[model samples]
Target: MNRSGKAVIVLLILLAAASISLSGVIYYNLEKEKSQTNNLSVEISDIESEKARLEEKIDEQKTELSKVYARLEQNEKKFKKLTFSIDEEKRKSQEVVSESASLRKDLADTKTAKVDLERKITQNQEELDSFKLEIAQLKKVKDVLQAKLKELTGDFDVELGKIVIGPEDASSKSSPRIDATKKKSAASNLEGKILVVNKEYDFAVINLGARDGVSVGDMLSIYHKGNYVGDIVIERVDEMMSSANFLSSNTKEKVKEGDKVVYRSS
Candidate 1:
């Protein structure tokens, strides 16, 4: 009971102390490992969430890029169409300009032609006026020459004697006796009368006839109370009557049934 019991009690106390120390060290290590594991799990979860967000962003960027590409293609097409329309419009404008130039040239040519034609017409009109004046002068000269011939021919005296005395003066009882020399003198100085004026036939009937020397183609004059009325040509003749046609006349002065007939001495 003495030494061996004391030694056994000491050994028991030492074993209990050793056991308590080992348990405390083991519990502290376990708590530290658990904390490290929780931290690692939280970090992994955060990395997974960040990776999903990055993938969604990448998809959205791809969609936007696709829209941009489509817009660029549409713009290119619009540009090409606009270029074609501009070229067509330019071609049409050039054509219009060319047509306008051609029309202007034609208008200028027409104006020049009109001016030339007007000038020619004026010159022609002047020439025609000159011709008319020349004709008038020639007519006056002809009339003068005709008057001179009538005076020289002595034809008017022969017509005068026939008009004054009726034809057949050689055998009529009522006929006046006329000497040959006196008859010649009377032929030079006789005036006459118109027995009938036939307007429908444009002729005058006179008492003078063939026997008194009246013949066809003889010219006679008509008068009304000493005023000259007209001129006539003998168309027909008989022994006691003759008819003459009015050659040139103005009938403003009336030639009635009893108007006087005469012969102009040139």
Candidate 2:
């Protein structure tokens, strides 16, 4: 019960209270650290799950990318084929244009040739007409010459016949009765041979002449090989030969050289 004894008891009581407070503080700190560690573990597990989901998304994107690349390759092949077809069509078009040009040139040449042919034909026709005109003019001149020659030849043949027949008296030449009698005598038994025949002019020449009683306007019969050929009329007379033109009515055959010529009464 003294002051020292009481102070010692109080001090012991204070120490006991302090030790209890420290033990309580240490237990509370240990419990807080255990709770914090459990929260850290939960956070790590959630982060790992999020990483696995992101990887799966990346794999899906890669598969889609491969399909897109395949489709792009197919489109490129189609483009190449289209380009080739377009080039082929262009070549064919060029060939057609060239052919058209050639055809046009040929057509123009053909037209030119046709025109030239027509011009030549026209020139030839003009020349032919000119030749025909010249022929007609020659025919007219020949007819005039033939008529003049016939008149002169008749007079010469008469004089020659008088001289060869021993000369006629002047009164006998003037007498119509004497002339008629002479003509009647000349009509009998007159025969001769054809010296020449001209089929183009339908005329013949005979050996019989004025001296043989052949005169202009006398009718004669023609014969070949005993067959009657044709009839001819004396056109011109000479001393030794006479020219006669054929008659169309009874000309059964063409007169030939050496054919027989005989006088016939009208």
Candidate 3:
């Protein structure tokens, strides 16, 4: 009875040890699997966060590209404006150059005209010397005649407002007498249209008179359109009108109605 009880007790102890060892191994394996599962969950969370960050970065880049595009469009508009300004300035420069060329031609023509006028003036001076010499001879003859008249009449007789000698009677002097070319006057540079013209009487009527500072004896230059026609001497002046006699004329033109009249002198 004792031996059988001892053997049964030993077998029960052995079975209990094996069962505990098996339970310990299963617990360890389960714990390791649980730790691996937790690590996987954390990795998934990290991946999701990374994806969100990447999406945000993409949106930021898109916003930046839109800004760049807007700036490019504005720059293009500025470039167009600059190009237009340059073209406009170039056109204006060309016009100015053309005007400069025209002005140079006009200056050359004016110089040529001045040379011709100077030549004509020299010709007139030669004729003036001849006339002055003739006048000197006439003065000598008049002096001899005056001496004979004084001897016959006992005294030299003279009349009022009449003189035998003129104010410019220095014949013995070598200096020449010169008539000056009348200069243009600012106050007398008035212009008016002719109201009437008379070829037979050689007279014309003008609109400007005393009220416009025009008086009798005032010389006026006449022009048909812009071309020179003649000159006129004022004979009568009314309140707002005047009558002028033709004093001179161009060989090819005559004073006519609607012609412009201004102050003139030779």
Candidate 4:
């Protein structure tokens, strides 16, 4: 062999070795880049899952807040109702107090009126007692006057014939004759004395009866101490007793027991 041919063979061998080393280095770098890309994609997916969970918790908190607001509104309405009830009770209490005051005033006025009525009753009773005392005093004075008049008059006891009747006659002869006739008529009339007086019936029982010329329908005059008391009409007559009814001219004077009953001149 020649020297120049040997140098060309060595140069071709060196170029082939350099090309193989460059190809191995490029394949190793490409595999390492692919593995890094896969790891990055997995990390991004995990972050998205965590965000969805956080959003769900926020929605639940909002729903709870709405419930709390609703309860607060209901409590406010209850407080308003309680306040109105308290005001109504206070108004009713005021009305009851006013009515009690009015009733007490009326009761006090009624008590005052009752006291005045009692005072009037006492005054009227005292006046009635004073009037009764005055009447008793007047009765005593009248009795004294009646006794004095009786003492001044003379005794009137006499026979029936001696008593004058209506008018006197001028001549003594005519006077005797008239006197005789009057005596006969007077004797025929009823004459008696009161034995008992029945004030309730306004009647009297006489001592004279049919035996003394006394008969029913006979008129008699009752007298007390020569003063005319009343007139009587005979109702019944027996042998010694007669009953007569009194006819009053004055109501104040009453015929009593032991009064004289004389014949009335017709």
Local accuracy of candidate 4 as per-residue lDDT tens digits, 1-266:
68765554554444334434433443343343334334434443454444444444445544544544454355345445544654666665755555444444544554454455445545544544544444343333233323323322212122222333222211221212235455446556645677766554566677776546676888888888788887888898754467788777362146766788898766
Top candidate when judged by TM-score against the true structure: 2
Compared with the true structure, all predictions reach lDDT values of 0.55, 0.59, 0.56, 0.53
Candidate 1 per-residue lDDT over residues 1-266, each given as its tens digit: 79866655555555445445544544453454344445545554554455455455546555555655555455556556645665677665766656545555555554555555455545545554554444444343334334433442343344333432222332232223346566544543455567656554477777665435666887777777777777878899754457788875465236765677665567
Q: How well is each residue in 1-266 modelled by candidate 3, as lDDT tens digits? A: 59866665555555445445544544553454345445645554554565455555546555655655555555556556645665678665666656545545554554555555455545545544544444443343334334333432332122211222332322322222222322223328678878766554467778775546777788888888798877788899854468788765441246666788888755
Q: Candidate 2 lDDT (Cα, whole model)? A: 0.59
- Assess the local accuracy of residue 188 in candidate 1 as a C-alpha lDDT between 0 and 100: 38
For lDDT, the strongest prediction is: 2
- For every model shown, the clashing-pair count is 0, 0, 0, 0
Candidate 4: stretches off by over 4 Å: 1-186, 189-191, 249-253
Q: After superposition, how far is residue 265 of candidate 2 from its true place, in Å?
A: 3.9
What does the lDDT read for residue 219 in candidate 1?
A: 76
Model 1 bad stretches (over 4 Å): 87-266
For residues 1-266, what per-residue lDDT tens digits would candidate 2 score against the true structure? Answer: 99866665555555445445544543453354344445544554554455455445545555554554555455455555545655667665766656545545554554555455455545545554544444444343334334434544554454444432212232233211237567558655877888666554567777776556677998988889888887899999864567888888347246667889888755
**Higher-lDDT candidate among 1 and 2?**
2
Better of 1 and 4 by TM-score: 1
